[model samples]
Target: MHSLPPLAALKAFFVACHAGSYTAAARELYITHGAVSRHIQVVEKWFGVNLFIKQGQRRVPTPYALTLARELGGAFDTLSDIALRYGNGGRNNVFNVSVPTTLSLKWLLPRLDDFYARFPDANLQISTANTEQLHIIGHYDLLIRRETSGTEYSAIPFLQDHHCLMASPALLKRHAIERPIDIFSCPRIETLTRPGQWNLWLKAAGLDKSAGNGIRRYDHFHVSLHAMLEGIGVGLGPINTLSQEISRGNLQPLFAKITVAPNQYYALTPVGVQKTLLHRAFEDWLVSQGQRDIKLADLPL
Candidate 1:
């Protein structure tokens, strides 16, 4: 017979690795902190080694523990995917989709009602993560990500994205940006996730990349967009996603002729996977909506 630690202990340890602390894991697992500690202790004893050790005020997983956690994460994810795909729930129109965080917040989430109205029976389980996280996350019927050079999945074009300089009306007024060069006088807001965006926009506008007065970096595009809306700085705004904000005069797109960094969002699925009716319906709907958006915005294909 195979010897194994208690299932509860393994679960506690797994959650603790990702949660970053025992207390956080306890909170997530709905167990007392002492109970979580006890569970982890059981796993440690079963393995004949310490999985976590105190480092300053935090408990850090050992290297061996980190490796174990990675394997366990994949195993648990596979199990979850299998259950979701083959269980009775799978017979329904339930579909799991992973999307980028900012795109989901600013774009897809707003348009989901339309999808629901069109197909009342379709149930979408949406998860948001960055492009990097999508690689580590579990199985999904579909994923929305920017078109990258070497993606392994089959990609279908979902949306068009073009970047242009944009800032709040008040901020633009304060900065007196009469020309592309004048933007350097304003603080340049950037996202840590897409550090090359500012450079790409600047280069497309025929300006030096290093000419900005100051750089402020946020961890995500949504945060940077919010900062720009607050008149903290100027940022590269995604034309299609922020169209409403521009139309309402909340923000102003500058340099009408200098739009750059044309990228497309793609609906991706693992290569060679069977496509179900749910997948076909959602994909068709997404493409139709994306096309309609471009047509209504009077943007080029």
Candidate 2:
């Protein structure tokens, strides 16, 4: 057998390289910064090379270290794939799904019981992360994300998300917002990630896009939606994410007469695994449930 550094040391090295600091690596690995540094030192001693250099309180990987990291990352990915393929016997029934945090909390979690009820025997694991980072589809049986036209995976359109103005009934009553233009008179809740959303909605509504002011920006859509729900202000709500609240009268739609092009929600699965029974069943159920929740004609137009 070839002499190799300890797996922990290798892991620490990889995390350090990826995270760019011992402290960050430690946080990710659930160890102390000192431990991460020692692990890196161990790996460096085994390899007889300086893997990183201090640059303004950050550990920057050397060119050779970067090359090594790339190779090691690929190796780890391959090993993980192999382990996932054969580690669980044919009886393995676990289905792993990754979804965006907002979508998970606002949409999926509410209906997860139905899924569990239908597939009680199937082990289900749901993880939430940024949707943009889900393109890799690693270690997940399925991903729910905004539809991309890429051919990397087989995508099933689940929900057509249209942006609309939404607010609590109390907020509307307080502001006396009888028309779309009246929304600018109240506090406008916006998300940092989608700053242009209000402009898009305004332009679609045939109003001056630059008219709104006093915008309060939050880092996440869920937080912004919560602010609107608590009667803080009006927010640009994606129909798919706020449909249940609107249906329940917690949020009132500002203008249901105008509609804009929609960003679609898609259920993505790796091409090779699409034929699996669990994958197919989950996809079918998700699509069916999504259709039942919002019909095409029901979409604002």
Candidate 3:
């Protein structure tokens, strides 16, 4: 017989580590914070090590806890895939995808008609979730995400995530922002989730951190982009996400010569499953369409 911690304890530990708090885990698991705490304690006692430490009113996962959580997450993902594929007798020709909302709005939705035209028989169902939780790999057949280093799944690079400063034409003219440094005089729109984006882009452009002043923060990139479009301030815009806006003249690029090293958009599939015909067809179609979009966006007026 195999010995292991109780399944409930393992699940609580996984959710707590991922959610970053017992309360959040409790909400997600439909349990109380006290129950979440007790389950974690059970796991910690079974392992004879502390999984989390109290840090200034927050429960932070230890390094060991993070490692264990990642492993457990992967195991759960595999089990989910198996159950979805076999236990329920998987549906035919239906492809489910998880994507970030901003990407869905700015990039994917615009070109979906072409996807359907090419693959009429394929029923594509897309769901959106917070980008941070994407590492969990739920029931979706595929996930489109910003490429991160060292992922366990098979990934196909779809779009280059080149970033640059973007602002409405009205804002630029109003601020007389002729140069990159001039942007500091105007409000700087920021995405709360990617706090370091402005810093990284400014550093790459050879500007000091102080140049990113007059800040307005938004919880999501889409909101920040909307604020920028409303002539609120300049924002760091990734090419894949903002290309259509630039093309439509809703927003214009600033300091075009100064660009950051491109990150990538990836189409991630479960490990060892990329060889399937349906997965390959969709990946190929997606990549080809993305390449076309990038080419058109990169062209000079």
Which runs of model 1 end up more than 4 angstroms from their true locations?
A: 1-74, 132-134, 148-151, 208-212, 294-301
lDDT of 1 by residue, 38-129 (tens): 99999999989999999898787888998999999888878877776778866855688988777788778878898889888877899988
| RMSD of every prediction | 6.1, 6.4, 8.8
Off by over 4 Å in 3: 1-91, 148-151, 272-276, 295-301
| Highest lDDT model number | 1
Summarize candidate 2's per-residue lDDT along 1-301 as a digit string, tens digits.
9999998899899988898888899999999989998999999999999999989978888989888998899878867765665575855666778888888888888887887798887777788885466555357778888865577678888777777788898897799888778888999998887768777788887899778688888998878988999999988887767778878889877676555547888998766664578778888888877877654356443
TM-score, per-candidate, Cα-based: 0.72, 0.72, 0.66
lDDT of 3: 0.81
lDDT of 3 by residue, 1-301 (tens): 8999998999999999999999899999999999999999999999999999999998989999999999998888777656555554554555778888888888888888887887787667788866646655456778887764465677888877777888898897799877668888899998988778888888877789874558999999888988999999998887667777878998888776566647778888766453456678889988887777554245442
For each candidate, the alpha-carbon lDDT, in order, equals: 0.82, 0.80, 0.81
Tell me how many residue pairs clash in candidate 3: 0
Better model by lDDT, 1 or 2? 1
